[model samples]
Target chain A: MELLGIANYLVLFLTIAGVYALLTLGLNVQWGYTGILNIGVAAFFAVGAYTSALLTAPATAQPPGPGLPVAVGMLAAMPVAGILALGIGLITLNLRSDYLAIASIGIAEIVRLFLKNEEWLTNGVRGMAGIPRPFAGVDIAGWSAGGALYLALTIAVIGVVFAALQILYRAPWGRALRAIRDREVAAEAMGKNVLWFRLQSFVLGSAVMGLAGAVHVHYAGFIGPEAIDPLFATFIVWVMLIAGGSGSNLGAIVGALAIWAVWSVTELLGQIPEEPITGFGALRVFLIGLLLQVILLLRPQGIVPEPRE
Target chain B: MVELAQLLIYGVVLGSIIALGAIGVSLTFGVLRFANFAHGDYMTVGAYLVLPFYAGLQLPVAAAVTLAIAGTALMAVLIDRLLFERMRNAGPLVLLVSSFGVGLMLRSAVQMAWGPRTLVYESGIQLPLLFGPLRIKPDHITIIIGAVLLVLAVHLLLTRTRMGKAMRAMSDSPELARVSGINTAQVILFTWVAGAALAATAGFFLALDTNLRADLGWHFLLPVFAAAILGGIGRPYGAIAGGYVIGIAQEFSTLVISATYKPAVAFAIMVAILILRPTGILRGN
Candidate 1:
């Protein structure tokens, strides 16, 4: 019985790690390949998660959403996030990478404001709940079986995304992005439409981030502003990518799994009561933050450095 | 008429705090070529640092503020020597991300130490000093004067001091400055000192204006960045104008929009500036 409980815990961990893997992949497309500094990961994550949850929310929910199929909710999330990216990208993609980072942070805050204040649309601070899991009606007999099935769905999506990104980054389009990132003037001289290419990459990456958010909400079976904290949604992904090898697809998955393990472990340790320290809530964040510093100093390319072409 | 006047007064006071913080942000970015995302936390640390001197030890307000600012400057210098100095050539993205990590560390440390409770410097509020239709706090007046004096001092230092010239030279062209026999390390140290000192003071003033919380500086970070960008990147003078513009705009916006959405006003203005006048109002570098 204890072993069975452990197995269930492992499934839950893998599912959460898989969701983070998606975010890392999305960031890999932007920071790793295209060299765009998008720090607004939370914004897109919130959009996708809330979009799906709101649409699929039960009829009994307050301020009622569409009561649509979970499939519809998941399908619409990507485009909504993509459209947001398109609007911000048109203006900010021209900025120097640092300014772009600041602007993206602003965008995230604005989205948070919208989610917190717009009751009619987002149900305000109460947030949209009652989101159905991927296969809510399946008679799995227990939470463990249902969770395992969803874990399979998550892994399957990760497989498809990993394969698609592997192909995308190897094509001529990928080479041009690298060239632009390495030497923008040179890429422009080579007749590559630099801004246009950047816009496409930004939109594509954000859409994937949206998909990650949807996957996460379905797994958790809830959606709210608190779930998409910037500390988790944005900064953690950056650390995972850097720790795994930014430009490598396999690295994103590995980094997600590794960092999520560290985070979970720290969380467990933080739960232990201590007399002098009342701030156990901050233990994991403080540790993870320190980890980033150590990574930058020692092994910046991550545990698995980007593979040489 | 009175309401508009009151709002304008509030605008000027809030603008003073932002300008102080913006100068630090603008100067650091100009010299270091990276936005120190930890800057807001710099202010937060400053505010917290003042507590031991002022409340715990019962020191005078000015002395407490001075010691706190000095401590924040030292911390910034140590941070630079320990971390940023090593990554001088790591490109902007690495530095920016590292700085963000540093910010998280600072914020989390604060949470650990202080236990995430709202703190105040003084227990009771002082009645506002009225100027016809306007009402202002003594702390607000102090903020405005302090900012003006500090801005003046920075202006003189930049225009008249040799160290200031070297810093500007590096900002304009690193190679040229290197060839000219400037002490690059010394200039970098000075930049951190100046920026962090100002950030600490701005934060202290902000705490005096509003209540103090662990997330105080983090919440206001966007406006400070907006002020820096609005004036022009790498331009301290531009940051001052940018600060006032954003501060006033936010205050006046409350007349039309919900108060809950004040932060978005800064963002909207920042976006507009990025689209229309990317160089900033003062044509910054």
Candidate 2:
């Protein structure tokens, strides 16, 4: 609770927000750029977290588990998450936009439920603990120093992702996606495989979410299915994208930071004493809900509004 | 045979609840022309609102039930007028997102009013009615009866009545209904009243079977959506049938899969239905 303590908290918050920024950017690429409402984004996130955690968290001399190095764990997470997304997209790609949204939500929920119940793989509700950090033996100065280090690493990853997305956005493939999004039939007439484009967007989005999750797991040093709850993925990320301006990468990053700031402050306020502040916890949540409602009603386009044609 | 009978009874009872839930979703989707993710949360609020009536006032069972249903209906209509109606003309995405906001607000409000714990409306209600190897409870019977009465009333209201016809016209084509001199706003209000009444009633009956929790309707929203889709979106009768199909499927999935993984069954069925035929089983459209 000291100033330094608050700084430490801020650093931790920024790191997590940066991770979400990555996740939201992945969503923006799918939803904003491609108009594909991928509601099951969290499934890949779970895959990544579970993958990294299960692999890196030293083998417990037990059966039915695959424990590997953290880097390798991160590597496995991307393909595993991507493949799942591809499978889901294959079945759902032909669906209308709204139905696609509903299906993805269902898929995310199913993945979460599986992770929560599949005790042999996920350790069930007890959750996996003791996930190791890279360079665990190194005297990382202090928790604040660790926070700074994590933030720097996240920033690096974000930079790389942004660069890659920049290239895609400028490429012919990206233009085709935009065409498909803006006018599916016209894009179809032009011989663009709309379904295939959608599937690719979905798989790529899921991969990005997985990478974010991999970073998040190592940072938080734990993994549980609850971490990828559909509500968190849909509601929170939706809010972030809207608050930022959906179609813009910068908007996603800014929105993630701003919303995460509000969330953090409200969460902290919820814990504050309530002599003159009765029901602060509930009030904080209420305010967040109110904030979202007000935003949607007054400015449906959002803060950094996505440019309209 | 007895086990099958029992399953059927349970399925019907569950179906009744599903019917009630789907009414809210279908009506909102049909009339409002947008997916209201918050619709389930309203059911959650309706159940929570029952706590004061049933538990606090300690009124007679029927009286408390009536009060709860009325209060929830009023709340739903007010929400429609104040919130949903404003966004009625917005694009689907805007409406969807706004409803999410509304749902979050309602959920937080409930969590604020009543903490994140489950409660029951204290009752001296007895055990299941034994019929051979099968057993069913008074709550189940009440749910079936109540849901049937409500649905029949809605059916009558929608078809036999002038207002009902207007609603149907509106659903078929809102602008045409308005041009035809139907009071579009009034029909919308009526739809909310009817849909919310069904929802609150379902919430109450669901609370009877389980306990009242803030997340009750949300937990059921997926299966309820699956039911609505299975029934072909906006058809009430289809929804009723679909709900039963969903309920039975959900319960039976547990026999094949682990009980813990039973919830995933709803999504699997939903995906299969969508992939196989997006129009759904009933073919209302």
Candidate 3:
């Protein structure tokens, strides 16, 4: 069997990194810019993926494909995912930060549980397969040009969202969000509706998470309940935000890419030639534990602290 | 009448674990002032710790358990001293995320070490005690007795011992305690050791009934948190009572709903309590 070329592996990594970057940016808005500390960003991402996949995946008595055009399915998936986030925020966002974190964890689980158990809707644990790739006709021979194409699309989508977020960050509304996040009571005293601003952040973040999910499903060509497990959502997003620098949009993207590099390298390191290492796989986990412990101990402010400016 | 008795009996047994686990979690949160998302993993690690020594090494069950408890406690202390102590002044969010990262590391490590398979420790001693209208296992009886004794010990230590008093004082008001010349760091260490020891003990009991799996603590995490919140954060006794209540509610909820959904019951109670009475039944912060 032939090994994957470096270029192909790079493309795969970049595409995954791009999707995670989008998701991390959404979290940066909620946790960094808005101070919400949502631990369940994965749930909304799952929602968008499932909603679009269900809509687009072929059904009995229907054509054998995700039924709608890729673009339309993507569009419809966004608001549905946003609404779900809004529902969650309305119920749990009013609580204290710790409480919100706990609730978000629960909410993420609930979403995964629903998708896992709701076989009729999500096809249960088997997951939806054979998801249509965009611009399939332009595929390069046998190299899975689909990955490069998706990487391009992911870059495009991220560019649009990043630009839009940039606009929002400078706008008066974004300033209001920053104010509320810093001091909710003081922001309220200043005539800003704190709850409303928070809710807006939730909706917008969820929508971005949803869009990221849409790109993820289309790129991977498979979607599953386990894909949105709280482990990946909570841990990965937190790592990216911490490593990336939180409140900065650039920080979120950079963090996502950098952490992905760390994770991949660690996984590769686990495969190094070491005979009789006695639980080497587990050793890597211990390494991650050690790394996190050291990072928290030495650099709680992270590699790049959210810039004051 | 029979059904109610069974519910109460099962609830107490389940509650025993919840009570122990919650105290571990709540005490950490109370003293440290941040949510430790990884506390659940301690339960999983404790359970996993016993398997290697008890099953793999063929050590006697009691000896293996002692080792497990001690090992888990040491691990907790090492984590506190090595990781948590350094973040003494960071935002609570940093602590929370750190706990999560720690949890992920611990769990993945267990999975890698143990290969994600569930293993049961074969018991050499089984005294299946019989009670009128209620079947009880010897392990269950041991767990209840142990819980009661530990609770008493903790109470005495808190009220009678200088270290315990210092811990309570610090938890109540760290600044005042510091100003009053109490060694707050020592008190914090005591809190972790005590809490982690109880948590590991509970994890041992949990492994005794169900096989030890990597996700055992994650599965139990919600209920433990629910119990802690129901009893009110920072109140050890309240957490114990809340544990049993939550445990019983969880097992009984299965009678009406699917057994798989039993876990959600703990979370539901937690959400209700948080929304309706954030102060909780015992009214601690």
Best by TM-score: 1
CAPRI level of candidate 2? medium
DockQ of each candidate, alpha-carbon based:
0.83, 0.59, 0.51
lDDT of 2 by residue, B1-285 (tens): 666677778778877888789877887777767767777887887777778876788778778777877887898888777777777676676667677667767777887788777777775667778867778887888888988898888888888999888878887788888899999889888888878777887888888888888778877788788888888877777787788888887776665788776667778888888878887877634
The models' CA-based lDDT, in order, is 0.88, 0.78, 0.80
List the TM-score for candidate 2's chain B: 0.94
Q: What DockQ results for candidate 2?
A: 0.59
Q: Higher-lDDT candidate among 1 and 3?
A: 1
Q: Which is the leading candidate under DockQ?
A: 1
> What TM-score would every model get versus the actual structure?
0.97, 0.93, 0.92
Clashes of each: 0, 0, 2
Candidate rank order under lDDT = 1, 3, 2
In the range A1-309, model 2's lDDT, one tens digit per residue, is 498787877778888898889888888888877888776767778888888787777755222346577778777778888898888888877776777777777887788878887889888877787786664444454443666767787898899888888688778988898898888899999999999998898888888888888988888777776655557556777788878877777788888889989988777765666654554555665676677767767876667775454
lDDT of 2 at A192: 91
Which parts of model 2 are misplaced by more than 4 Å?
A: A1-4, A60-67, A140-144, A227-230, A274-279, A307-309, B123-125
Writing each residue's lDDT as its tens digit, candidate 1 over B72-92 gives 999999999888888877887
Local lDDT at A21 for model 2: 91
